[model samples]
Target: MSVEAIVNDVKTRADVVVTRGQEALEVGVKTLKTANGIVVEGVQELVQTNVSAGKELSTLVQASVTKAKTDGLKAVASNPVAYLPEGKATVLGAYSESLKIVSKTGDELAKTLKSGVETISAKIQGQAPVVAKARKTATKTVAKAKKATKKAASA
Candidate 1:
């Protein structure tokens, strides 16, 4: 081929490489944005779960305290000494119920985290093939350019 034709071919190849590079860059940016959205969603879910748990715990404690107070008052009207064992049992029951609430909260948090991780991983994995294909195309374009240059020089 003439020098002019060779130069044109090389230029076309370079353009293809640049276009592919841009496509790869765009895909990376999109992936990053998607990941950021997932993180935000995850955080929101965690906050909501924690708030719900807090409300439940607070309500339970309040109810338990109110009951204990009422019972104590009744005992005082009768015999205060008889109230001690019942008070201890009530406190222990409250503690046990509180532990159950905390355990449920922990479970909810773990599920949220797991869901976030799975979503992020799926997004990244989905983009992998597109990025790899772009890289491969870029590499092939470079190799072709090199070969064309060598042929032109020898000509």
Candidate 2:
């Protein structure tokens, strides 16, 4: 083959590699942006749920404290001689109720977390095919570039 013909062949191969590389990069960027948006949306929803749950827990605690104080005062007024033991019992009962509230709150938080994780997992899984396509394009671009380089050097 003429030297000019070899040179032309090399230039054509280089152009094809460049075009394929650019296409792959565009696909990758688009995929990344979509994935990032999905993750941000998921995180925002999780945070909102947590904030509301925290507020509810705070309200419940405040109510529990108020009731415990009122009940303890009533017990002391009814029987002054047994005030110490009655006060202790009242305090213990309040603590037990508080513990139950805390346990329930914890369970709710766990459920929220589990649901959030599953939703995010499903969304990410949906993007798998797009990601794979981008990866395949990149791999093919690299292989073409390598083959072109080898041929150009030999020529």
Candidate 3:
């Protein structure tokens, strides 16, 4: 089979694994939320901690990608089908590159989620008073906008 086909198969398998992990995490979070009053607060703290730890996870994954690349190349090379005719080497090379690409994609996703969480946490911390104030402000703004639109429609 082609390297692209092999990579697609690997990706499909990885996606299933990731989905299961997310589901397990969700269950844990839900269990914690229901178990104790303190768990709710603790879960929020956990989210903050996880966000901060994202960078570390990204770094670890990057290292893992190096290992995966080597292993993936080896697997491709060892496969009799991958060592077929003319473009076997090229296909194997592409397969190795695909592993790196998938790893990098995962790293990027972690970094993005970490950055977003950090930003949201910082904003929540920095604007505790302002958030409440903004809520009222938003309410009034929406009311006024609705009134104006209604009046324009009538006119």
Candidate 4:
């Protein structure tokens, strides 16, 4: 089955669950959205830390993707799906394929993220010392200007 079909099935299932209780549906959606937001923020922080640590960001991204795929598969398997008209084998096969695609995409993203992190780290590391020196020079220049101004005011 296509990814779209699997997603549609999940949506329908969630709707059915929601029909049982409005509060449950609202809570579930809110929790999922919050989790997604946290994940996005965590990824950004990981990228930034990789730049500072001079480490490859790809490893962190890859690990996260792998975990997400595993969690998704588990959720699909555990979810109640008796309402679907499809045979068990067909539904299971589709879910499995969907999981496989998610894993594959995650692996590719991990590689891309790692490469990007490495590049950013290298650039930052290369420029860090220069930036520090420039800041120090600027600080001294400012101090000198202030001293000159004070002397002039006194005279």
Candidate 5:
């Protein structure tokens, strides 16, 4: 084959390689987006689970306290001498304390979830610009390399 024909063939192969590289880059970008979506979904599910667990715990506490109150009231009525007025149990106070504890725990979980989401979003945002800059730099470098190759082949 002639020199010009071989040079043209090599250039064609190089162009094909560059095109494939760009395609791979695009695929990577898509994968990144998919990964981000998955992460967000996972975090949301975790937050929901946390909320559900808090609610279940609160329900259990309320049920147990209600039963205890019923039993105590019976005891006080049956034995007035043993259950003095000064030593009388306050059901409302117990329930109020339980509610406060549950509320505090739920609030903490919510705050943690919010903090985690903000961190993940910030990191994802931070990586995008760097990836974009790298891709731009790579395209420029590839173009320069192709130009140099063509010049050398022609000479």
Candidate 6:
């Protein structure tokens, strides 16, 4: 082949290489941006869920305390019989019920928080395979594009 023909061929190949490199760089940047976006969305969901759980827990705790207080007052309120020797059992029973109320509410709050965390974790896990598949597809497409461009340049 003539020197000029060889030089032109080399120039064409170089141009193809440069174009493929640019495409790969752009794909890399886009993949990173997409992954970061997904992560940010997942984190936002987690934060929102946690906030909701906290509010519900606060409300439950308040209601439980209020009920305990109201019931205790009612049990001993303005009753001479309540303070008499026969009223000790009544007072102790009210206190026991009050403790049971607090314990049950505390257990419920723990379950709520646990359920919230598990839901968030499940959502995060759910997004993973999708992102992985997207990345895999992108990688395959980039590879195919590179191969086609190189073949066209050679021809």
lDDT of 4 by residue, 29-91 (tens): 543443343344334433333343333334444655565566676664676352223334544
User: Residue pairs in steric clash, candidate 6?
Assistant: none
TM-score of each: 0.41, 0.47, 0.27, 0.27, 0.37, 0.40
What is the number of backbone collisions in each predicted candidate, taken in the order shown? 0, 0, 0, 1, 0, 0
State the lDDT at 44 in candidate 6. Answer: 41
- Computed on alpha carbons, the lDDT of every model, listed in order, comes to 0.51, 0.49, 0.46, 0.45, 0.49, 0.49
Worst 10 residues of 5 by lDDT: 83-92
lDDT of 3 at 90: 43
Query: TM-score for model 3?
Result: 0.27
Candidate 6 least-lDDT 10 residues:
122-131
Better of 5 and 6 by TM-score: 6
- Candidate 5 wrongly placed segments (more than 4 Å): 2-4, 69-155
Tens digit of lDDT per residue, candidate 1, span 17-49? 676566556655544544444344434444444
**4 or 5, which is superior by lDDT?**
5
Give one digit per residue, the lDDT tens place, for model 5 in 1-155: 99999999999988866765565555455434443443443344344445545666666667656655777977757865553332113444445545654554454334433434443443444332224433344344334534644554455
User: Candidate 5 versus the native: TM-score?
Assistant: 0.37
How far in Å is the alpha carbon of 61 misplaced in model 5? 1.8
- Candidate 3 per-residue C-alpha lDDT over 44-128 given as tens digits, one digit per residue, 9 for 90 to 100: 3334334434545566556655655666877756764533234444445545655654454344334434433443444434332
**Model 2 stretches astray by more than 4 angstroms:** 73-155
Candidate 3 lDDT (Cα, whole model)?
0.46
> Where does model 3 exceed 4 Å of error?
1-84, 127-155
**Top candidate, metric lDDT:** 1
lDDT for position 90 in model 6? 43
Best candidate, TM-score: 2
Given candidate 5, what's the lDDT at residue 47? 47
